[model samples]
Target: MAQRLGALDLLILLPDPELGILRPAPGFRQTLPGGSTWTELLGRCAGGGEFRATIAYPDVQRLSPADVFITPDGAVLMLIGGQPRVRASELAGAAGLVLALLRSEAREDAASASARASGDVTRRATALASSLDRARADLAKNAAALRDALSDAARLNDELRLLNETLEQRVRNEIAERAKAEDALRQAQKMEAIGRLTGGVAHDFNNLLSPIIGSLDMLVRRGVGGEREQRLVDGALQSAERAKILVQRLLAFARRQPLQPGAVDLNQLVRDMAQLIASTMGATVEVRVELPDDLPPVTADANQLEMALLNLAVNARDAMPGGGMLKISAEPEQVIPGKSHRLRAGRYVRLSVSDTGVGMDEATLSRAIEPFFSTKGVGSGTGLGLSMVHGLALQQNGDLAITSREGAGTTVDLWLPVSGAPAGANDGPGNAAEPLRGSGTALLVDDEDLVRMCTAQMLMELGYRVEEANSAEAALRLLDAGLCPDLLVTDHIMPRMSGAQLARLLTSRIQDLPVLIVSGYAEADGVPAGIPRLCKPFRQAELAASIAALMPTTAIRRRKDVRQ
Candidate 1:
């Protein structure tokens, strides 16, 4: 019986605490003290004591003072100092009387202890299984989070790459656009230069046309004393003169006219133009001339310079339709040393035309110098006046400046280089000498048949033997074939070879031969510097005067020698 109880105690301490068996103790059939068989009492006491000892003598050696007990007949009980704390005593007594009861109850307790141990083992295994399932669920959640993070990283990388490509493309497009803009700006500047050249030629040719047209109209009205032959001559002259003026205007716009530069006093010129402005603009617009006493003389075409001033005054008049002041002034200034003004250190005569009228803003001012760019309504103005002024200033080695504000009005300043005074007093129009008699042999080359014939007749009337050629090639052939005229007179534009080329060729052959260039446009090619020039539609007297003025004189001969 002791050995069986000892085995039961060892079983309770196993790693699986609930896996054990209990049985009736052998050779102890009679009931012991307290009305219970010895085997039954020993079984109950031993199982409870073993469980209590395990709890009390935990491997760490601290014991709880609580008794663990099992009752006979398969009932569990706890005792406090040998008093029953469970209601299993009545059931144990009813199972059998004394000895029989104790023996039967021992058998039942051993079975109950075995059953209780099995139930505890089953419950523990269930708890371990639930823990494993929870661990698997946590691992799956971690894996899903890691995968999502990787996917997000890949998407962000793609977006960054696309953004980089877009930025690069935009940069390339901006560079191309800037290059196109620069090219367009250059082309606009070239066209503007061409327009100014055109305006200057028209202004000068118009002056020459005034005299010719006036003379022709007079002759036609008088009818040359009314004879049919005289009438035909007058009609022909009048028609030819009108046609010549039209052609001159066209050539001037094309910048092919020949210029005749001379000394001009800007202060005097402004004063003279002021009178005309006063009369034309009427009493409504005041014409004021503010001339500086120390104004320097500029080298330019005097007539053209006067015309430029008159054009500006007229423009100022039109600007102030409600009437305003037209101020023309002249001053002496030094060319400021800078890259903007390509002038060297020298004296300059500043001529200004200002007005108190509606002005221009930045956009209009930028396009102001362009030919045919006008703010005035259609049919109100031709838009060539300001451009002409710009060209004339440039031709005289000067600069033009414009300043304007939207409501503050505008001012135009023309800077001309200073020139030394003439040796003697200037011969005013009436005091000039009569046209000289010229018997020199002259070659006249012009593309226009009427111009050629008219020019030839004028030379003949002036007592010169005149030969005519319609083209530079024909003129060159005549000269090459030993037709040496005393002077070469040629129009600038021709079908083959220009007048300048002919002049250059002739110069090589006869080094001292004088070439007089006649053109409606002053800027035409091959019109050599320092040569005498006559604008078209010139009267017989003007033509004769130019030829005589250019005729080799003692003074000219000396100057030529000095230059050589």
Candidate 2:
């Protein structure tokens, strides 16, 4: 009947009444995937409970017969088939007939056992006890296997959860890093555009200011007017000086201002400015200095550094309207490559100004160094303080760093490279005495009529016969026409030939001719190396000092005689 039904061989499975689990009878081997037992597989099936009920109650009338049937002795008969060749009802009837035969055989066995019951009762009891012991052993083994499987599944789940969390965190970090890089690129581009525009405007402004400042300075020094008139001149002069300072600040932010970089003693500079800082901060604020005695000198412009410090102090004072502690400190630092985006790997001295006051939020701090971006009320600030400092740092191969929190405080650090040379003796303030007088022909060349007239007057006032030229070519023509000047002062950035180029050409032609190249901006390649330079909008005294430094009294006299 099994062969006719096209099913696999019929198997009889007995239900363990004690454990309520199914076990194939001995000599039957059935295996499932992952080595799971048939008992575990069937227990997880949807109809598993009903199938077990049919096996346990074999004596009851069979309600429905399907692929599975039961015998009278609590045995399950399974017909495993890929496809049945006959109807399911026919199979069920045939299985019933088989079950009936088995039931009859079970009854015969029971009857035979009863006949021998008196003699074999003790032996029967012994056999049944041994089978119970074997069942107990099998149950213990199955429980241990289930426990190990559950433990493995739990461990795997924990590892998977941890991996997902780590991946999420890494993704978040990558996104944050990308955002920071984009912000930096945008900032650099904006600053570059502003610097170019500011630099050009400042250059033209400096030219116009030179003659005004120089004329006003002369009028004030020589006492050319009455008491009331003098006061007016002083007022005008004072206003012009203030204008000069503002232009310088703009130039500094543009990175076009010339800087006289030298080794500067940081400790001494801070000590000298302590009184000034205290006075500026006023009585409400407490000022503290924390500079180490053994601090190394840095390479920077002394005057510019002082100005930067003053600006920071003023900013701190404004931040603390109700007054707070302002701390100035310096320390040495070493940076390695790839450690910083703006700084190169080297030794640096970190000069920091920290204030206990209302600080900036992330939005404000991001644009703190942008030109003309100020939080102060109208007319209270120029908004170039931080940007000027930042430009100074970049010009000097340094960097600026800022840290701030909304309600905490702000710290600004100016990191400058450590100077290899010791601080020079001439790095201090200049002498306040009168400028030296010279007796010789001094050539003054500039393209602007007002600037040339103003500078020539300053030269004539210095006791030298002044020769004026409107351009470098004109100056060259004067030299070619047998006019030998003891001193040659020319303005840089003129048409046709620059001051530095003219100086180079004249030096090759004449010997012992002192040349001073003056300009508004710091054109590194515009001027030849080893030539003396003077920044534009110079006072009579500054001009005299630069001239005297180049051509001393003895040198000037000697050069005049050689020309004679």
Candidate 3:
């Protein structure tokens, strides 16, 4: 039968089977179809299972036998001629409506599930982005901290460099200051030595001058006409000669006397000094000489060495108040290395003066070489003995060392540079002694009135024409007035012009004039280079010998007539 569908037809068919399957919809198709199948028409018409039957003939027109049944829910029953009557439900319209409702519900469920999944994906992406930002912030913080640390380290390095430079400058300045201090100390020591020698010479000069002046006063008052007067004058002249000898000794000790350096044998020197040492020590102290046969000669001033040995001998004798042995010996020695003894390295001749007497402690020994330092009581000792020895040792490029203990004894060793040749025998004391002799026109110049007058009187007695001047200016005036003497004897240390200056001026006027300078002070600074020196407080004999030695009769007779 050709059917017509109603709303009841949708109810008789099965609901769409695809309604439970959900899937991702395409971009353009979001909704499904409502009713497109015949099954939908059947479901819309059927309500319950009841139906009615009907039949109709097409050609014959007669009263038809037909039965039609209808159920309460719109089902119908029909009968045919040859078959039993059948029943069926018609629900085409009703089934179609139900299919449309189920399709709409399925589309709504798919849209809801898609919305939930999109929210979950968005949350995961946001969390990942936040973690990346945090990591970048941490890197920036670490970089800034590293830069600040580097800057601080560079500043500290600059400060240390400046500090190092300042320290170096400070060290250099300290070294310069120390060198200056040492130089000043050496100069002070030299001056102190000179002062002590001056004091000793002056004291001895005054004593000798007192007696000579007193004797002259008596002779002048008594008149110069008698043999007795001449004898008294001669006695006074002898005292003056003693004074001159003392001055020469002082100059030798001071190193101002011209040194004639030559090779001198220490062994021979000590042997030659034996008798003098014995005579000076007398019967109290026994003298012994231990001269080595193989001892070498030394290069030094012979006269100065003799005087030094005598001084040491006298000192040794004085040390032994009670009679004791004074032993003098000579040997070869090598100075200990790396030790500062003020002597250079070389073969040396060591001369030792040992005494069995009361010795000295460390404090006393340290000051033994110092000028004016002495253990002897005042008025008994001049204290220049050891000082003179020390000066002589240094002047000769040698050194002196002393070893002693309290109440035991003392040993003084003098080290001198050795020479190649053997020493010659020294002349005996009696054979070497010579009386003073002179005959010439002599000019005596001295700052002190007593020294000038004493020197003049000695020259007159020695058969010389003498002119006296109390100062260098007076001597120059005398020379200008056509008074050309054969010899010019002047004091080295004077108030205005020194003896060296006077000699220069005189020698310029008269080239061949002989000059002899005398002074208690031994400084060679103001003394002429080549002029012969005679120290102050000299004796008549010493003055005569110096005058005669400088101006021999043959030379004097030739120059006596040359005026101005």
Sorting all predicted structures by TM-score, with the top scorer first, yields 2, 1, 3
Best by lDDT: 2
Whole-model Cα lDDT of every candidate shown, in order: 0.62, 0.78, 0.63
**Model 1 C-alpha lDDT per residue in residues 117-186, reported as the tens digit of each score:** 7755555445445544554455445435544654686799899999999999999999999998897689
Model 3, range 259-343, lDDT digits (tens) per residue? 6567887767678779988999989899999887877789888888898899888888888999899999888887666565367
Residues 8-55, model 2: lDDT tens digits: 445556667789766665434443122233433354432432242112
In order of lDDT, best first, we have 2, 3, 1
Model 2 pairs whose backbones collide: none
Question: Which of the two candidates, 2 or 3, achieves a greater TM-score against the reference?
Answer: 2
lDDT winner between candidates 1 and 2: 2
> Runs in model 1 with CA error above 4 Å?
1-187, 190-257, 335-347, 361-363, 377-379, 420-441, 463-465, 476-484, 500-515, 522-530, 550-564
Q: Where is model 3 poorest over a 10-residue stretch in terms of lDDT?
A: 2-11
* TM-score of every candidate: 0.54, 0.69, 0.53
Clashes (candidate 2): 0
